[model samples]
Target: MLGFMDYVQKCFYRASKWDEDNSYANLNATARALLDFPTPKGLKMNLSSLSSPNFATSYSMASLGVVDGSVSYLYSSRPLDNALNSGDVQLKDAVSGYRDLREIMKPDDPRDWEIWKGGVRVDRRDTLLYGRMYLPASTLEALYLRRLAPTRQLKISAVSNSRLPNGGTILALLQQDNGKWSTEYLYSTDVALIGMRGLYNFGFDPRKALPRSTTATTTALDPRKIAGRFSAGAEVYYGILNKSGGMSTGFRYTTLPSNVGSPLTVTLTVNPLMGHFQASYAVKAGEGAVFCSRYDFNIYSYESDLVLGCELWRRKQGDDTAAAADASAAAASGMSAGNIDQTWQPETTSFSREGARDDVTGVLKARITQNYNIGLLWEGRYKQLLFSLGSNIDLKRREQPFRTVGIEIQYNS
Candidate 1:
């Protein structure tokens, strides 16, 4: 039967459909040849495939954020004896929701894997540098939502808005054209950052407002600024970030800010022999020379299995401009004049918030194995589809934590 199969092949020679097959089919002839294509009774060929130079670029970076999650206790620091006597709020279920949704995107196997295999065929650097894109589009969108900090607590109905806010992504990618076959380093530093998220307002007229300049809906390639409606802002900040891991130590003062704008944002991730931890910090000018800083620390058993951990949050001299409002219940407990108890009255009747402080606020969530872990996020941004919900869970002093939900269909291209 094998001999007859070969004889039939000689009678009808055909152009190998490798190219078309690769485009339409999930797997390719080359892959089949390598993996399962039957060989003539123990025959072997050590032939390698051809690779492309386009994958020569080296760099990668990425960021992971919760689509929606919150952390709060059923206990309150100072529960109002009048309303609901429960000293705390329940947030475990919400925590579990996000925990389950966390996406650990591997290198896009179909495209990037193909690129990886392609880089392997060429004999260039023994190492291929690959990087990832951070979710900046989402980050900024969330940041705006963060300006309100806990969006659920905000008075939006009176604010006149059209679109619901959600999380967006601005990512970067840098992968070695080659694989573990290289020796440069385990990962690449220069990444192609892309942001695939934005914030839409509560204003949607669906109907075009008519072009005001350059043309009357002409489809010609003429010089004009009237293509369509324009949304301001959106600075493009796609660039290579230094390999900031391992040998990196605690904050080393590179320099001070010379401009009046916000300070440089710094992100730190640590992988000591014990666990993996991350911190995000930023600086901004306040009423005086104070530099507001917010820092959080989480240490978990680095082992994928048997992971246990605790987290500490400290915000010393941090900017309040972006702080989201806690829920009505929480805000009413602490800052509201109505809830003020004379026993713990302030020194002055007129006190204004000049800056935030570094307090020992904490939330800890952990899973000994991969099944579960729990932690409280103070105030963070989240994205749904076109709608992004800021402060999915704004865990604050007196307010009960409410889940902020939105929908964001995902696309990884």
Candidate 2:
């Protein structure tokens, strides 16, 4: 019994102030909370270090369309650093033998997450289909077929449009536009990453945090606040998102503000190595100071010095990523974009993403993957922003929760 209890304790263990130095330990607060159980009073469980930083590699080799590589490094940080996860000395050295490792592990890919993405998403009791229209139009220095009416732009976003679902769902990025160069999410949701994310995305499971409890479902979200995925509905989230880390925030008030539903839901999304496959994450706050991550995709035009882009950013939800190709056509005219930069695009074409996940104790395991995607281009006059659409495809366990193909238009200087 002691051994069993010890194992349980280790599985759901929380970190102390000292261990907080580690990023992996810092963010696992949620994982630990969902796993925390009880012991005799005044007792502490000393566990052997489960420090095998999770390693992920693709079984296939790089092919014509599919970029092949391996991700053997384990990232263990909360706050992002210069390189993140593998940037750690131990992880970098560990992966050195696999020369192609760098090609497979990328932080900026829509599906790739060097250490971790934003947060987890929830599941609808029924078939949930979320559709949104994200339009970014700025007549400043924008371009499009409506160059005659240069101030026109619109967009739409959907989540789980088609499915016969029944599996542990992990929602990463679903779709994206383009940034050329940058290190932010498809939709930036860092605006309100604290409570909003803490309550809904991961669900408010108080049981795991309770010293005496081992299960997670019995706990509840804040009764007065109208929290949890089942409780809230969609609205609009906004803020500024750029390189060097920026802020993004918004709010959502639910249709039915309060209910006693399942309070624990963690979607274990896998990152596709192809770098273009997109996934979205719902944000959640950590134990200490609250930090946020947003998912996004934008479609914008740059005509002259005027730049307009349609965007969808879920402060804790996710964004749009659609840029216009013709944005550079009018470089000599007043509609020409002098200097608009795209610094968020990923470095390579491959990646391998995986992580250990535990939801309500029954399903506590790993979500490993190696995926690839080709660019989605529709340059004719798809919508606005000079259309060329693409997506990230995650190859993981039982769930394939996303598919993206869109039209775009752009007007450049």
Candidate 3:
């Protein structure tokens, strides 16, 4: 983790990765630790974990996870949407074989939660103050964990492709606990893009959101129900640099029984500048089958980007059993089975952009009991290729004619 930039630098110097220094790589390494915290309540409080002096110098953070049967709660130093959507805890059943974080907590406790575990940051030799308080109930709607807005913030530097020596940005986010609605507010002082987004979830069926349907009989069903039929949202944006901004709107609709099928998601986004659409689908091959496929398409400039991927999990159940056993053993020993796993996973992903560039990646991973894993990832882009080899302890080493290595040690609690 600490050596991502070093690895990229090595690659660039050797002419193996790209001709130019990848801005994305530098930005990625610059903020990796500060951007995401452990999900389902795993804390990363060590400044050493984040090499950035701005973040690590004097800040503290913690994560707490409370699981009482099927009702689980997470209090973390992160956003609720981030925790619910991509975080470790899974509260939604598979739909067409896809488990996305758009789902919330257990059906019984359906609200999404966010806590502003405040921290101290040193920016440009100045200490700026900011934090948030959660609002348990909102009069604006019949929502739990709603309107966390009495939030306040001060001038903070914004990270962007274009640097601003004397500029800063402020951000605000709002959401309903049940994933029914959400919004974001942003303003930039350094002449970056300022924008606002508002969204509403229209047709998610609570009965379907549950692990099991509540119908009294197999033949009984609700006539008005449809699996998260569609969601609509709008964005109003202005660019300080361009001196012009316009409004844009988008919506996503899905079809497939809320339970299982090759669910197809089609999205359309339109603005004064341009319009594009994306379609994605995912499905389980069949009961007891270990193969699954997920695909995505984005249309732009009359060209499109397509991603095709599949996962073959022959030992999925075996890994689950091993995890359960590890959990039991950890519980008996008064330790957490936080990051322990012994499982094998195999997968492949292929990407084609604008029908000109193609990349294919294959991964093989094996988890050794007591929180260890050995994995290899091979990727070929056009004629350029690279391979990585690693173990849980040693992590990944990128190899080419010249090479760079990064060591990442994940902590589980």
Off by over 4 Å in 1: 1-177, 181-391, 400-413
lDDT of each: 0.21, 0.20, 0.30
Candidate 3 or 1, higher lDDT: 3
Candidate 1 versus the native: TM-score? 0.16
Better of 2 and 3 by lDDT: 3
RMSD of 3: 18.5
Q: Candidates sorted by lDDT, descending order?
A: 3, 1, 2
Best by TM-score: 3
User: Which tens-of-lDDT digit does each residue in 191-270 have in candidate 2?
Assistant: 32211121122243322222334344323323223343321111122334332332222222111212234222222221
Candidate 3 stretches with Cα past 4 Å from truth are: 1-163, 167-179, 204-228, 254-258, 262-272, 284-301, 311-407
User: Candidate 3 residues 326-385, lDDT tens each?
Assistant: 658845664322221111000000111112111112222222212122222221111221
Determine which window of 10 residues in candidate 1 has minimal summed lDDT.
Answer: 143-152
